[model samples]
Target: MRIGIVGTGFMGTTHAKGWVETPARITGFCAETVAEAAALADQYHAKAFASLAAMLPEVDVVDICTPTYLHLEQVRLAAAAGKDIICEKPLTLDVETGAEMLRVCEDAGVRLFVAHVVRYFPEYAAAKKIVADGKLGKPGTIHLRRCNYRPKKAAGNWFLDDAKSGGLLMDLSIHDFDYARWIAGEVKTVFSTTVGSMDKDAPVDYALTILTHEDGTLSHITGGWAYPAPNFQTGLDINCERGNIHFDSVASAPIRVLIREEQNAPDVGLPASPLAESPYTTELKEFYHAIAQGEAVRVTALDGLKAVQIACAARVSAAEGRPVFLEPQGGVL
Candidate 1:
């Protein structure tokens, strides 16, 4: 399969690397400038197309690694050209646009795969499997923490712009939001509190969102771009009626599970295995295989839409200082 990548930023470069690990050919790239696309194209031994329209005919699949706001137009262009799409996460800045993107792709009979890479992470994937397998009977409370320093190299300071990047919650915390919903089920309500500044000179931003799932599972998700130290950390603690599963990036062993036994016995911790390949690579490979085999994608466009909806709702909740309840149809009401 031929692949054309859009956006020559960090994510665009990362997608190029992941695609190289697969059997697909990196046909070329489309970016803001010829030089930007050429830089990435040179690394992959591919061409640098001058425009998305020019790049479309050269490839069967378009991998969109552009910013959140650019997704709809890119997806529309690709779908119009009858090309399959792989879009970067938080599909679009809003629900209507994301829904329209999905509708266009479906009407065009082209596959739409959203890159929610966290679902492919070994630890996170295992946690989902464990919960699905009933190993953690009736999950109750889930605590997820993801913290990292703000992107110092964000050109034009776009990452700090709430309208552009959706600030820390949409761009950074959406991973945890997706994961939480994946494991806990549909979110019924969301209550959120945000602290820190979006000022260009400010060094920090943080947000905490509490999600109540339809299944009665409560998830407390905390995300930050405010760490003084140069460290990235992500951890998950899932408490269930039977036992619990935990993973901390800072821990000696990243993942561990404990299951209750014989009514009242000591909890026995079981070690979780590590992934041989990066989740990004795995995610691309899965998308490739799904497209090749005409099978269902693991991360569907609807999943991406729901995640963005939740994140957008969180933003509303934080702004209004009230818990936002979601409709059964995945909209805040």
Candidate 2:
């Protein structure tokens, strides 16, 4: 498989690092400018294209790591070129365009995978397995927290724009929203509240969302952009009929537990994983195999769209200070 990257920011660099671990060949890169593309391409010993149009014919997959607002156009171009796509999270700023992108890819007979890397994390993956294996009966209540500093950006950067970045709910909290839906079930309604501002000069942003699943399972998600660098942390606690699954990035070990007796505090002190490969790399490798050999991946374009739908509903709930109801989804792609 041959791939062409289309961004040069942090995610772009991180994706590139993962792509290198796959069997796919990194064919080229196309950034906001040819110079930027060339800089990243040079590091990977790949070609640098002046435009996506120029890069399309040279690769089988167009890896889109561009900003959320720019995804629709880039994805359309890639689909038009008859190439598969690997888009980063949030998919887009809204579900309408994300659905269109999925439709375009499907019509063109190309696979569309979204990078929801949290699902691929070792701790999260382990939790998923434990839940699936019936170690924890049915999930009841889930609490997910992701906190990190505001993205380091220059003045007038798009990260500060609510319309472009979708603030913290879509940018950061979408991970939890997606994970919540994945672990519990489809969302039936959402109620959310937010603090801080989306102003360019604002130093912080935060949101808390509550999702009521179709099966009555509840998920509360919190996202914040007020921490210092290197202080970023993610924690998840899932309560179930049998036991609970817990993980905190700041802990010595992120783990899953099976409760036997209702007496005494459950013993819990699992150790950190010794594996060197990152969840990002594992995600990309899975995507590569799915595209190259027709395997199933954890995240698809429809999943991405639904994630956006959930996040958008949260945005609306926050804006209106009322619970937003979601209709049963049919075919959008």
Candidate 3:
């Protein structure tokens, strides 16, 4: 399979690095400018195209790592050209646009994959496996934290634009929102509150959202763009009926899963395998093979849409200062 990347920013570079290690050939790249694409292409030993239209015919997949606002148009073009798509997260700025991207891809007879790469992270993947294997009875509560320095770029960068980037919740917090849905079942209700981000020009922002999962599980998710640059961390804590699972990026150890299946049994700590492979590479490899060989991956288009729906709902809850309820729309939301 040949892959064409459509951005040269951090995510685009990160995804490019991942794709090179996979079975797919890094055919070429195209960004807002040929100069940027050429730079990334030169480093990765691939060709660079002046436009998406020019590059479509040469690659089997279109990997979109552009900003949140550019996804709809780029995805429409890629799907119309009959190329499978790998869009970086939040799918699009809103549920309506994201759904349309899916519809366009479906009508074009191509696959639409969203990169919710957190699912492939070693620690989170391990916790999910424990829950899936039912070794911890059932997950009852989860707390997820992700924070980093606010993105900076040219004067009018879209990162801070609420209408364009969906602000912090849609752009940053949605990772844990998707992971929460992955660990538990679907979300039933969402209540959220935020600070500093509502004005769209705040120097830093923080948001806390509480999710009530359909299966009686609850997830408390916190996201921020307030940390100092080079000072970032993400951690997950899961409390289950039989035991507990925890992982902290700053923790000086592997993921610790404590199992206590019996009423009086001693708690046994099992350390998972250290993350040897980049989750980004694992994600791209799974996506590459799924496209090449028709296998199922950890994430799907519906998962992407559901996550965006939940995130959009969270934004509404925060803006309206009320709880928002969600009803799954048969299959699509």
Best by lDDT: 3
| 49 Cα displacement, candidate 3 (Å) | 1.7
Show model 1 residue runs off by greater than 4 Å: 197-202, 253-275, 330-333
TM agreement with the true structure for every prediction: 0.90, 0.91, 0.90
lDDT of each: 0.84, 0.85, 0.86
lDDT of 3 by residue, 1-333 (tens): 889999888788889889988978898999877887998899888898988999999998999998888998999999999999999998987888888988999999999999998999887888899889998998899999987767776566677778788988998889999999999989999999988525645677899999999888999999987876644678899999999998877684555557755433111111224666788899999998899899999999888888899999998999898999998547556
> Candidate 2 lDDT, tens digit per residue, 89-201?
88998878887888898898988999999899888888888988997799999999888777766445677678888988998899999999889878999999888523445
Q: Total clashes, candidate 2?
A: 0
Q: For residues 286-319, what per-residue lDDT tens digits would candidate 1 score against the true structure?
A: 9999989887666788889899989998999988
Looking at candidate 2, the ten consecutive residues that score lowest on lDDT are 263-272
User: In order, how many clashes per candidate?
Assistant: 0, 0, 0
In model 2, which residue pairs have backbone atoms overlapping below 3 Å?
none
